[model samples]
Target chain A: MYPKSIKDLIEDFSKLPGVGEKTAERFVLFLATQKEKDGILSFSSHLKEMTDKIVKCERCHMLTEDTICDICKSKERDTETLMVVSDSKDVFVFEKMKTYHGQYHVLDGVIDFSKGISPEDLNIDSLLKKVASYKEVIIATNGTVEGELTAKYLKALLSDFNLSITRLAYGLPVGSDLKYADELTLNKAVENRQKY
Target chain B: MYPKSIKDLIEDFSKLPGVGEKTAERFVLFLATQKEKDGILSFSSHLKEMTDKIVKCERCHMLTEDTICDICKSKERDTETLMVVSDSKDVFVFEKMKTYHGQYHVLDGVIDFSKGISPEDLNIDSLLKKVASYKEVIIATNGTVEGELTAKYLKALLSDFNLSITRLAYGLPVGSDLKYADELTLNKAVENRQKY
Candidate 1:
């Protein structure tokens, strides 16, 4: 009703992120040029299906179908040294590093007081309860201002406990020689250095 | 295992008509950034559904579920005149005009001898048969060499029949005055003018 099929399809494609009107028109033209067997309309249905299905992991707040994520279910992971992150993608980043052996806790979002997001808005309370049983908890939040505030809030919440709580150090990366490190990074590395 | 998710997704997106590696990368990244509740992995499944579903109109060769298209099934329209077009979208153009009281015949494609497409390849026999039952048949193909050639071929094919066959008169569009018309369009309009 909005338009005949072709125009309607173009309008729909244009609504997607990064697809402009011109690009939407072009995509529709390209789609129409395809042979009947290509099933362009069915593709729209499929898009709706993907958007409708799929579940997020309950334990870590990452995307997963099971009640617990693969990392949470695994016995080989270091459950006592949990890594806290803001998003699920960060978990993947840590996994790809092959260095972190600990399980993960995803906040799903960073705490932003300006946007009205407080500690309660994040999964910090559950993380604190989880940390009560562990010997150590590592805050692997990003080095941004929001991340720093979230980590500091978390540190205060756990200050009464005797467990070791560490924030992922921000310094020059490995193999990035001291000479090539940016001034701020070199300065941080110098300031945060532990006794040899 | 070879970044199974990202690698497979990149490969699949890259296989689309005009998507290159960088665009494919961007597409995968966009999908990856989406919430897992959105079923990003099921994008592949959706692609399969599109290719497997959707039907074409048997009568007009347009994308439709029924044998006869909505235009052909409408009883209020005059069935005497048939506007012959190359694809389904052309029906939209004519529908926008709302001046003609005629049904449509979608040819699907024009006769392109250079590409080995002959009169038989474009459902010309069906068009000729339909023209026999019509008072007039209008050829509304694009203003290209191939379109013209196809129109000429249709005229020759329907020469022995007792029906009037006409092509859309080439000219400047209705909104444009003769002063603004391109030289080719103005010349064509003048050449094809009828007595008022």
Candidate 2:
């Protein structure tokens, strides 16, 4: 129904995480009909640049152009505290907050039995080597089942490390209405009620 | 928040319709972290190929690799009936139905007054020349304000030509429930009700 190049582009676009065929078609059409004659060419060059330049940080497995990411190389960060997250994107989210001064260790993925992902598949070995020096290890993975499973596994593994291990607190989010909160969230909120 | 090349790629992705900063971030991350290392590079090369290959049909303004589109060059198509559409994507949609055998004239855009897009910005002059020989001209624009405006303006411009001009029927879509139909759609359905 579309030209060969357009169809091929749509196929490639569909390989992205959340893009479907319809959205891919729209994206390809936008590139094809864009008023800027050099837009698609520039976009192609940018993709090539990303492919040539981007690399993973050697120590933490986070995305960076250098061998070590800026967060890992920074001297201002709190070296005693380390946050363990499932993906590099989570590190970016935490960096946006600008509150946490701790270092990050990207696991690349979590323990998901359903998907056959396990501790060995993650960066747990490197984390074990690094954990002995940190005073605190915060498990900052998502609130999903895989995240909790990974945290539990890590806690048991790091029991002998003599460092305080903590997971992010569960409660109703700020600016959220109690009525709309799910039962589990409401329960967590009640259980973790603050001194205030 | 992201590396320079990643940020540049994200900015380019954000230019597409319906893509936002967050979605663009995800797309770049997907390309960066995909298991197939050559994925992003292949995608870049494909984009270059599209830039070099895709061209518009000389007669109808539809996208094609050659000087004339397949539909415009086909001898089996009904030359007597011409469908005027707002974009090439619309022509693809009609072709997918496998029912419409008429030739198409892509306006490339509609008469969007708010956006200052007039008939001159469209392929109206060529349409005026082609409508004379055709027995029927179907205004197959969208149901939006711009689409209707373009259809109305074309109707007046081609009124001098000796041909039957028709717009798509306004009614409840097939398989849609009357209870969920909006007031305007219900009104149009009632006014255009057929003899059952």
Candidate 3:
């Protein structure tokens, strides 16, 4: 029982992953209240500016204003090592870790058999062409079944290529002691143990 | 450790209520991903437009584009009864209920002794002037101590006026059974029981 416009906004916001009715209501109310705190005109203008100006990088598919991504265009990055992820959000996470100076390729989604997604649905062809120039391709997809299947599919597709393909080494988590590692993690850790 | 611009945007989004670091990150990423979604730019632009264009109703302090609130400017509303609320949010709630037919007066805040807010700090002077025109005043503040105190202050300030003053009667909620009501509510229910 809110105004039609308010209700519509709430419904649209509620479609987000975690927002519920209460949160949706709070968000719309918050937006409505901002009209009083800051001039509503500026807020609306900002939204339009962001939507109109923000564009995706043509090369890496990450959000950027340039024709190519900063990572892909940067001479400082190791272009020979391409880190592939299912979504751009994963790129943000790794960027937060301040690790890896290699360029990135976002698939935008995993290859899902159940959903009828195939290799043709992914940006894998571009990746294959790029692999000719790169020495290594690192698959950083999630450890879920679909992610694993996608990784396997990519491996099979790139089998004829000369570049070295690698998956992130499975092991005990950084903070977790070896003794506290779960059975599955322990088994994977043992199987993938390094010489160091 | 994302890019400086990304970090700044995330920080700004995080200032909103109920949005944490992960959520802020997700929101930014979602905005970034909108490049792939159709009409997302238009939606964002619409939000910005609303924010930029909306203005406060000078009379009732509700968010609107007009000089006075639609309710206040309406001829059908009863000018003899005024409902006072602490904020415009509460005004929205009352409007949603569609139960009250009177105009509203926003205090913006309560008379908090600790906060050094007295009756003079609020729109009480204007409210007193409104009292002359109205036959009854209803204080529809929250069920908190500050709300009670504000209501009491209004009541005392208008004690000399010939008009009737009342607070909204709240007891057990509409859906709540008497058996499920708390002891405090049950006590209040018994104490304030009415003869039919």
Q: Model 3: what is its DockQ?
A: 0.32
lDDT of 3 at B76: 91
In model 1, what are the clashing residue pairs, if there are any? none
> How do the residues A51-116 of candidate 3 rate in per-residue lDDT, one tens digit apiece?
555566778777666687777788998888999999888887787777799989988889897898
Q: Comparing chain B with the reference, what is the TM-score for each candidate?
A: 0.77, 0.94, 0.87
**What is the C-alpha local distance difference test score of each model?**
0.70, 0.91, 0.76
* DockQ in order: 0.10, 0.79, 0.32
Q: Each candidate's interface RMSD, rounded to one decimal? A: 6.5, 1.1, 3.7
For model 2, name the residue pairs that clash: none
Give the DockQ (C-alpha) for candidate 2.
0.79
lDDT of 1 by residue, A24-43 (tens): 65665556557754454445
User: TM-score per candidate, in order?
Assistant: 0.57, 0.94, 0.84
Task: Give me the candidate number with maximum lDDT.
Answer: 2
What tens-digit string does per-residue lDDT give for candidate 2 at A79-140? 99999999999998899999999999999999998999988999999999878999999999
lDDT per residue as tens, model 1, B1-196 = 1134455555655655677866765665456557553354344343344344334566666555356667778898888888889977677667778888798888888888889988788867677666777888888888899999888888888778888888888877978777788898888988988889
Kindly list the per-residue Cα lDDT of model 3 for residues B1-196, writing each as its tens digit.
3544455556655766789988977876676566454354455554555555556677766666568767888899899898989887788788878888898888878878888988788878877775788888888877688888998888898888988888888677778888899897788777888898
After superposing all C-alphas onto the true structure, candidate 2 shows an RMSD in angstroms of 1.9
